[model samples]
Target: MDDYEAIRSGILETFERAVDAAGRDGAEATRRSLAEARDILAADRLRPVVLGEFKAGKSSLLNALLDDTGEPPLLPEAEEIATSVAASVSYGDQETIEILRDTDDGTPGLRVDRRGLREHGTEHGNPENRRGVLSVHIRTPSPLLRPGLTLVDTPGLGGPYLGHNAATLAALPGADAVMLVLDSSQPVLRSHLETVRRAASAVSATDTPGALFFVLTKTDLGGYGEVLADTRAKLAGALGRPAAEITVVPVSARAHRDFLAHGDEEDRAAGNLAGLTDALWAALCHRGVPRVLGGALDSLDRGVRALLAPLEGQTEALEDGTRRTVGELRRRALEHQARLAELRKGRAQRRVALRRRIDTVQEELRRDAEERHARIWDRFESHYLEEDAYLTDPQRLVAQLTADAAQVVGEINARAGTATAAVLVRTAAETGLAMGSSRPTEMAAPTSGDLVVRGRLGEKHRSGRLKRRLRDLSFGGSMGTTTGALIGSVVPGLGTAVGAAVGGLVGMAAGWASAGRDLRNEDRRLDRSSLRTQLQPLKRRQAAHISASVKDICEEFREQAEQEMEERIEQEREANQRLVAALKDTEDLTTATAGTRLAELRERTRPLQELRTRTAELEARTQAFTAAAVDRTAGGGAAGARKPEPVTVPGAAGDISWAEDRT
Candidate 1:
C-alpha cells in the first residue's frame, strides 16, 4: 500500500512538471488532458456497494460488515416498508451520520441526524419521501474500512417502488465491486438473482468481470447450509462459471447483532462473521486498491508521455543539426521539410479517423434518442391505462415526460461529447508529437442544454371557438363559454376525458368532433382512437424534432473537434516553417560556435531526457500494479479457503486483524 502511494505521488509530481512544460510550449490540449487525468487519480476510492431486494438484510449486512451492532441495525430498517433510499458508509475519525436532503432555499445540500434519517430517508416516517431525500451518509471508526474504502448500501431492486430500482441501477455503473445480499430463508429470491444478473451485466459491460460476489443473510435460520449450497449451485449455473469461482459468504446478521449485544467470543465465532470479514479485508487491500491505483497510473503514464513528446522530438532534431557548414544547414532544412510533410500526412490520416468516429457517435445519438423516447412512451401508456388515480395530476404527467426527455437528451450529449473529446485529444497529441511542439487546451464538445425540449408544450398553441364546443360536448355540456375561455388553450375542460395523457392536453379542439356526450361505448372508442390519431402526429413530430436536433448537435460537436485539430496542425506547420527559415538564414558558421550552440541545445534537452526516464519508470510501475491486480482478481474469491496469512500494513506495527472485536 505504501509503495503504491509513493509511486502515485511521484507520478503526480512528474505529471505536474509535464503540465508546466506543456503550458510553457503553449500546448493547451495536453495540459488539459493531464489536469483531468490528475483529478481522476486524486479523487479515486474503492467503492464496494451492497445491493439486493428490499428487506433482504441489505442494511443489516452493511452494519455487520462495518462491525456496527446497535439495535435496529445501525442503518435504518423497516417493518412496514416504503421508499428505499441509498446510504453510503465509510471510515471516519469520529462517528457521524448525515441525511442529504433538499431545502426550500437553493443551497447545495442539507445534513440531518439519525432521527432525521429515519423520518426522511427510511420507509417509515417519510415513506413517500416527498421532501426529496437524496442519500444518507454515515461515518464510523472501523479499522476494516481504512485507507479510503466506501461501502454503499443501495435500495432494493425488483420491489414495488420503481424509484428505488432506478436509483440502484443508476449507481451500479460506478461501483468497484458488488456485494449482493440475499435472504437465506427464501432460497435465493428471484429478485436477488435479478440484482446479481444486473450487477454482472453492468460490470461486464464495463469490461470488469469477477467484480461481483454474494452474501446470504439470516443464516441463523434453519437449513443455512442447504440454502448456501443451493445459492452457490444456482449462481454457478446462471453465470456459466465454476461454482468455486463465485464467492458466497454466509452469515446471520442476527448472530452478529447478538454478539455485539453480549460481547461473547463464541457467539461471534458462531455467526461465521470472521470468515467474510477476512475475505473482505483481503479483497479491499489486495484486489481493490491495486485496481484503483493501476487505473490512475495508466492515465498518468499516458498523459505524461503525450506532454513530453514534442520536447523529446525537438531535442532529437536539434542534436541532428550540429555540423557548422552551408551543406549542414541545407541538410537540416531538407530534413525539416521532410518532417513537416510527414506531420501533414499524419494529420490527414487522423482527420479521416476522426470523421469516422464522429459518424459512429451521430448514429449512436439517433438510436439512443429513439429508444429512450419509446421507453418513456411505454411507461406513460402503462400508467395512464392501469392507474386511474394517476389521472388526477395532468401537470405531473407533463413534468415527468419533460424530465424524461431532458434525461435522454443529457445522456446522449454526454456520451457523444465524451467520444468526440477523446478523439480530439488523441489528434492533438499526434499533431504535437509530429510537429515537435506541444499544446494543452481542451476542446470540449457542446452539450445538449440548448438542444433539449424545453418550455411547456401547452404554451405553443392556442384554441378558440372550436375548443369551447369540444370542451362543452366532452364535459356533458357543463362547461360554458366563460369556463372554456378561462381554461384557455391547455386543459380546456376538467371532465373532458383527456385523462392527463402526454403533456396534460392533446387536441382539446378535436375531442367533441371525435366523440359524443358521456364518451361511452363506441363513442368512447372513437374518442380514444381520435386522441391517438392526434397524439400520434404530435409524438412523431416531437420525436423527429429531437432526432434532427441531436443530429445537428452531434455534427456541430464533430465540426468543433475537426476545427481544433486543423488549428493545431496549422500552428505546427507554421512553427516548422519558421524553423526551416532559420536554418536557411544560418547557411554558414564556425565549428566552435556551432559546437557551443549544440552544447546549449543538449543542455536544453536534458529535462526532456529526464522526463522520458521518469515516464518509463511510471509505465513499469503501472504495469506491475496492473498485473498484480489481475492476479489478485483471479484468486481473490478463493483467498478465504486457504489459511490466511497475516497481512501487514507498511508502516503499522501490528498486522491487520479482521477478528478483532470492534464493539
Candidate 2:
C-alpha cells in the first residue's frame, strides 16, 4: 500500500479503538470528536474541476480522460450547451447515477437511470434548470477515480443561461485544481481572460500553487499551434506570470476516443491524453495531495487532544487522595461558579474594547483611503496636464487612468485589511485565544466591461495651445473607482460605485472634445475647463463608497474575532461546569460509595491508557506520512527512500505496566 493508504488505515483503526473505548467508558465528548475526525477523513478527496466556456469540450475531455467507452458515454455531450447542473464523477463499485435535487422540502438525492441524466443535466432538456437540480453524482469503477480523485464537470461560463455561469463559479472554491479548457479555434475573449483570472484567484485563495492548468482542446480539427501560443500568452498576462510558468496541454478528446477503439499508436500520440494525465498527477502529488493530507493530520491531532483532555482529568481526580466533606466540595463548586461569572464579565468588557479598537481602525482606514486618493488624483492631474499624448489619444488616456485607479484601490484595500488583521491578532492575544489564519476578502480587478467610454474623439493632433492653457489652469483632483477593489480589499455593494465612478471619468474624458470634434477648435476651449466641475460629483461618490467599504471590512473582522473569543470562553465555561458536576456527584457519595467510585475509576484506567497509546501512535504515523509526502512532493527525496512500518493496535486486555498502578 502507498504511504497515504497505509497512514489512513492506521488512523481509521485508531479512531475505531477510540470510539470503542469512549463508548465503554461513557466519554461522549471524546466519541463526538472521533466521529468528526471520521467525517473529515471520509470527505477528503482530491477534486479537480473542469471549467470552460460553453462548447469548449469539457465533458468530452472528462470522458476521454476517464476512458469511458461503454455503449453510452458516462458524461453526455451535445452540439449545444449540454451540462446544466454540475456533475461529479468518482469511484464506486458499480456504475450508478444519483440525481441530487433541491426541492421545496429539503435537498435529496434520487438514483436515476443513465438515460435520465440528459433530462436533468442538459440545457435543452432542463431549460435554465427549472427542475432545480443542484448537482448530479456519477460513480464508476474507473482507474482514474480510484485514487480518491473526483473529477467535476461544471456548466460552462459566459453562456446564455446565467445559472450556468453561477454554477461554474460556485464549483471553483471546492476544487483542488482547475483545468481551464479553452477552444483551440476560438480567440480568447475578455470574458475568457476574466474566467482565467477568477480561477487563478480561487486556487491562490486555497493556497494551492501550480494547481491551475490550461487545456486547449480541438487539436484534431486543424492547426492550432498559433492559437495555443496566443492563448498561453494571454493567460500568462492575465495571471501576471511568465508564459513559461503556465502549463498548457493541447489534446483532442475525439482522437483519444478513436484511439481507444482502434488501438492506433499515432492516434494515441496525437491525442496527448497520457501527457495531460501525467501533468494532472504531478500537480496532485505536489500540491493537492500534500494539502489534503496536512488538513487530515491537523484534524486528527485535534481529535486526539480532545480525547486526551478527559483522560487527563480523570487521572488527576483519581490521583487526588484528599478526603473532603460535602461542604468542602460545595465550597469548591462555588469558587468555580465565581470564576465562570468573572469570565463572562471579562468577555463583555473585552467586546466593548474590541469595538473601540475596530472603530479606531476603521477611522484610520478612512483617513488612509482619503490620503491615497489625494495622491492618485494628483497623479491623474499631472498625467492629463503634462502629457500631450493624452490630449490626442482618448483611449490611451482612459486606459492609463483606469490602471492608476485600480492600483490605488488595491493599495488602500491592502492597508485596510492589514489594519483589521492586526486588530484581530491583538484581541486574540489579549484574550488568550487561539486564532486561525485570517483570510481577507479580495476584490477582483476591473474588467473592460466595467469601464465604458462614450463618444468618439477626433484624429491625433498636437495642440500646443491646449497644453499651455491646461498647464496654466489650476486642476482640481478627485478620486475614481475601479470595477473591483484591489487584491486584498473590496467588499460587496461597491461594484456599481466602482463602475460608475471609474466609467464616468472615462466617459467624461472621451466625450470632452465631442464626437469627431477637433481639439484645436476654439469653440471647445472651455470644455477642458468643465472637466473639474464634472469630476467633483464622481470623486465625492467614489470617496464615500470606498470609506463605507473600509468600515464594513473592519466591522467584519471585528465580529469574526469577537465570535471566536466568545466561543473559546464558552468552551472553557462548559468544561468547568462538567468538572463541578463531577465533584458534586462525588460529594454525595458515602465512604463505601466513594470506595466503589474509586474502583470504577481504576477499572477505566486500562482502557484510557490503551486509547492514549493508540492515539499517540496514530499521530506519530500521520506525522511521518505527512513528512514523507511533503519531501516527495518537494523533490527532496525519492518515494522509496523509506518504508512505513506496520501499525499494530494493542488489545484492550493488554498489559498496561507503563500506566501508573492505582489498584
Candidate 3:
C-alpha cells in the first residue's frame, strides 16, 4: 500500500475503535462525533474537476490520460459537439455506468450501459438536457483512478448553452483540484480569463491552493510551442502569480494514442503524457490527500476530547468527598443562567456591529460602482459622439456600450462579494463562531432589452430643418447680390447675364453648404439623444443589479453568521443545563455511597482515557504523514507544507480547549 493508503487506513481504524468503545459504553454524544469523523474519511476522494471552453480538447485529454492502450476512448469526444452533463470517473472492479437525475421528481440513479452515456451526456443527444440528468457516473478499473481519485469531466464553459456553464460552475466546490484545459493553437480569450477568475473564487472558499493548474492540449498539430508559452504568461498574469510558478503542461492526445499503439519513442516524446500524469499525482499526494488527512485528524481529536471531557467531570465530582447540598446546586444553576444571559448580550452586540459594518461596506460599494459607471459612461459618450465609426453602425455601438456596462458591473459585484466575505470572516473570528464555507453568488450581466438602443440615425428634426432653411436663404441672397455687383464691375458688356448666372450659382452653393452643415449637426444631436434615452435605463438597471447582488451576499453572510452564533449559544446552553442536572444528581447521593460511585466512574472513564490517547497518537501520525508527503512531492513544485491550524471544538459539557500543540 502507498503512504496515503497506509495513513488513511490507520486513521480509519482509529475511528472504528473509538466508535466501538463509545457504543459499548452508551456514549451517544461520542458516537455521534465518531460518526461525523468516519463520514469525512469515507467521503474523501481527490476530485480534480476538468474545465475549459468548448472544443478545447478537455475530453480528449481525459481520454488519453485514462486510456493509453489504443482502446476506444473512455469519454465521448466529438469535434462538433460538447458535453451536456457532468461525468465523474472513479475506480471499480467492473465497468459501471449510472445516470443521476434530479431528485425533485423522486428519481433514483438509473444504471445503464455505455450507450446510455452518449444518449444522456452529450449535447447532440440530450439537447439541453431535456431528460433532467444531473450527472453521469462511470466506474472503471483504470490505474489512474486506483489512488482514490475521481476525475470529473464537466461541460465546457463559454458554450452556446447557458445551463452547461452553470453545471461546470456548480461542480467546482467539491473539487480537490481544477484542471483548466486550453487550446494550444488558439490565443486565450477574455472568456477563458473570466472563467478562470470565477473558478479561482470558487476554489478559494475551500482554502485550497496549488489545486488549480493549466493543460494545453492539441499539440499534435505542431508549431504551438510559442502559443503554449504565451498562454502560460497570460494566465499567470491574470492570476497574479509568477510566470514560473504557474503550471502549464502541453500534451497531444493523438500522439499519445499513436505512441500507445505503435510504441514509437518520437510519438511518446511528442505526447508528454507523463508530464501531465506526474502533475496530477503530485497534486493529489501533496495537496489533496494531506488536506483530507488533516481534516480527519482534526475531527477525530475534537470527538475524543468531547468524549473525555464529560468523563473527567464525572470522575472529579464522584471522587470529591464533599457532597453538595441542593442550595449550592441552585446557586451554581443561577450562575450558569447569568453566564448564558451575558453570552446572549455579547452575541447581540456583535451581530449589531456586524450589520453596521455590512451597511457601511454596502454604501461604499454603491458609491464605488456609481463612480466607475460615471467614468465608463463618459468614455462611451465620447466614443459615440466623436467617432463617426460607431455612429454609423448602431449595432457595434450598442455592443461596446453593453460590454462596458457589464465589465463595470462585474467588477463592482466582485468587490462587494469580497468585502462582504471579509466582514463575515472578521466577525466570525472575533466572536468565536464556527463559520462554514459558502459559495459566492455569481452576478449575471445585464442582457435585457432596456440596454438596447434602437433608433435610426439622420432622422430629420423640424427645428433643425427650419433653422437650416433660414440660414441658407440669408446666405444665398447676400452672396448672390455681392457676386452680381463684383461681376458687373469686372466686365462692361454682357455683365448682367454673366453676373446673374454667376450670382445664382454662388447662392446655390452657399445654400447647399448651409443645409449640409445643419443636417450633420442635427444627426449628431439625434444620436446623442438616442444614446441618452437608452443609457438612463441601462444605468438604472445596472445600479439595481449591483444593489440586489450586494444585498443577497450580505443576507447570505448574515444568515450564516447568525446560524453559527445560534448553534454555539445552544451548545453553551445545553452544557450549562447538563451541569445543573449533574449537580442536582450529586445532591441526592450520600458520602458513604460516593466511594462506590467514584470507583464506578473511574472504571467507566478508563476506556475513554485510552481512547483519547489513541486519538492523540493518530493525530500525530496523520500530521507526520502529511508533512512527509508534502516534502516528498515538494521537488515537483508543489506548495510547501504548512501546519494545520488548531480548531476549537465545542463540547456538550462546556468549551474544551484542544490545540494541535505540535512539538
Candidate 4:
C-alpha cells in the first residue's frame, strides 16, 4: 500500500476503537458511521475507479480488465439479488462520457441513497438514483487505465435523471477524473454543456483540479464532430474561454476489439476498450490524482452515527421507566396520637355508665339475700325448744347442710352471670372499642388486678366441732348433779362468748369461698395490658414489612433512572462529537456548508411559495364569487392568467421564481 493507503488504514483503526468504547446507542451509531467512513477513505486512497451504470457495456468493460471475454456480453444478463437502490462501480472505459442533469429546471438534488444513473431497461429521468451515489462499475483491459487512472460509466445523462446532475457532479469531491459519454447521433444540447461544465467545476474545486472530459458514442453516425464543435463554440460564447477547459473526446468502446479482431463488419464497432482505457488515463494524468478522499469518507461515517444517538438514549430511558425504579428513600412517620386522644373522650362516658350499673346490681343482690336469710331464721325460731336439741352423727349433718348450700349458691351464680354481662355490655356501648361490629377485647394479660369487695352482708350462724357432745341435751343431769356446779362454772357471759367466737370463724370461711369465685370470673374479663402484649409483635411485623417494600421500590426506581441517564449522556456526547466532525470536515472539503445556503434558499423561496399559495387561494375565491353571482347557469368569466412560480424548490439560493414549499 502507498503512504496514503497506510494512513487510511490508521484512520479506520481509530474509528474501530471508537466503536468498541462507544458505551451507548448513540456512540455505537457514531462508531458504525465511522466504519462506513473507512470505506470512503479507502476509495480515496485507491487509484481512480469508475461509477458503472447497468446495461451501459458495464459487464463487458469489467470482464475485459482481466482480459477475460469468455461470456456473452449481455446487459443485466445475470443480476444478483434485487438491489432497489442504485450502486457504484469503477470503469476504465475511455470513450464513454457520463454526466448528470437536473429535471427540475434540469437541476439535481442532494439525496442520500441514490446514484445519478439508471440501467438500459430502467425508467428514463428516474429520480430513484439521485444524490452522490456512484452508478456503475467496469473492468477493462484497456490501455487507458494502465497507471493510477480509471473510467466511469454513467446512465444516459438526461435520461437517467436522478433529479438534476448537480449531485453527480458534486460527488467528484472523491474523484480524480470524469468521462461524459454522448450518442453519436445527437446534437450538442444546452443540458449536455451544463453537465460538462459542472463536472469540471466539481473536479477543479476538489483535491485534483480540472479532472473532467467527455466522449461520443456510436461515432459512425454523421454530424457528431460538427455538433461537438458547435456546442464547444456555444459554451465559449457563454463562458468566455477556450472550449478545451472541458475536454470532449469521441470514441467507440468496441470498435477495435470487435471490428478487426472479429471479421463481422456489420456487427463489429469502434471505440475499442484498449483505446478507451488510454484516453481515461490521459484525462486523470492531466491533473495529479487527488489523495484526500479518505478523510471525507470517515467524516460521513461519524456524522451518521452522531445523528442517531439521541434516539437510542430515549429508548433506554423508556425501558428504565417500565421498571419503576428511581432514587432517594425517606419515610414520613405519622403517629396516630390524635386517634388516641379521641379515645379518651369516649372512655370518660363509659366510666360513668359502668359505675352506675355496678351500684344498681349490687343493691339488688343485697336485698334479695337479706330477705331469704330472714325467712330461714323464722323457720329456725319456730323449730327451736328448751329440750328439742339432740346429738347427731357429724357426717350426716355435714352432708345435709353442704348439699342445701351448694344448690342455693348455684342459683345465685346463674342470676349474677346474666346481670353482670348486661351491665358490661352497656358500658362497652359508650366506648368506641365496641363500635362497628367490633367486640370489646381483654384489656390486659392474665386478667391481673385486686378483687373488689362490695355490699354483701356478713352473717354469723353457729356450729362447732361436735362429738355427740356440744349440742347434747343435759335434761337428766341438769338438776341434781349440776345445780351447784353449773351455776358456778357455766356463768352466762362466758358461754355466750365461746359460742359467738365459733360462729364468727365459720362465717368468715364461707364468705371467702363465695366472693373468691366471683372475683376469679371478673379478673378473667377485660384487661388493657394483656391486649398490648398480643398486638405488639403483629403490628410491628406489618409495619416493618410495608416499610421495607417502599424502600425496595424507591431503590429500584433510582437505579434505573441513573442507568438510563448515564447511557443517554454517553450517547449524546458521541453524537455531538460526530456532528461537529462531520460539519467541520464538510466545510474543509467543500466550497461551503448548507448553513448559509439554507437561509439563502429559504429567502429565495419565501416569495415564490407564498405567491403560489396566494394565487391558489385567489383563484378559488374568484371561482366561488362567479358561481354565486350566476343566475343558476350563467357563463363563467374570462379565463385567468397562470399563477407565478408558486411552490417551487429554491434555485440559485435567492431566485423568487424558484422558491418552492414542500408542505
Model 3, span 361-462: residue lDDT tens: 767877876786677578776555676766665555655555555555555555655576567557656654433322345555554353445665344454
Better of 1 and 2 by lDDT: 2
Best by lDDT: 3
Global lDDT scores for all candidate models: 0.57, 0.61, 0.66, 0.36
Consecutive 10-residue window with the lowest summed lDDT within model 3: 654-663
Ranking the candidates on lDDT from highest down gives 3, 2, 1, 4
Give the lDDT of residue 14 in candidate 3: 76
Candidate 1 on 362-477: residue-level lDDT in tens? 78767866886787678667544233332333333343444345445544543454455455546545554322111112212112222232222332233454565566555533
Candidate 4, after superposition: displacement of residue 359 in Å? 99
Badly placed stretches (over 4 Å) of model 3 are 1-47, 68-72, 83-116, 119-150, 154-176, 183-209, 218-240, 252-278, 281-300, 316-338, 344-546, 573-599, 606-634, 637-663
Model 4 lDDT tens row, 1-663: 132233334445544544444433335644554455555544442334333222333433433433433333312222321122222433344323243333456443332212222331234333343433334333343432332234332333333233222223323434555655555566556556655554444344332333444455555545566766765566555444565443444455455445545766553434444344444443443332212331233243333334433233322323233222111000000112233345444545544555566456545544543443243233223321111110112122222222222222222333333344455345334332211111111111011012222212132221331222222222222322334344434666645445444444444444445455544443322222232243334333333432333334333433432332233334344454543443333333322433443344345334434433443343334233222322111111111111111321111111121111111
How far in Å is the alpha carbon of 535 misplaced in model 2? 22
Name the TM-score of candidate 1: 0.60
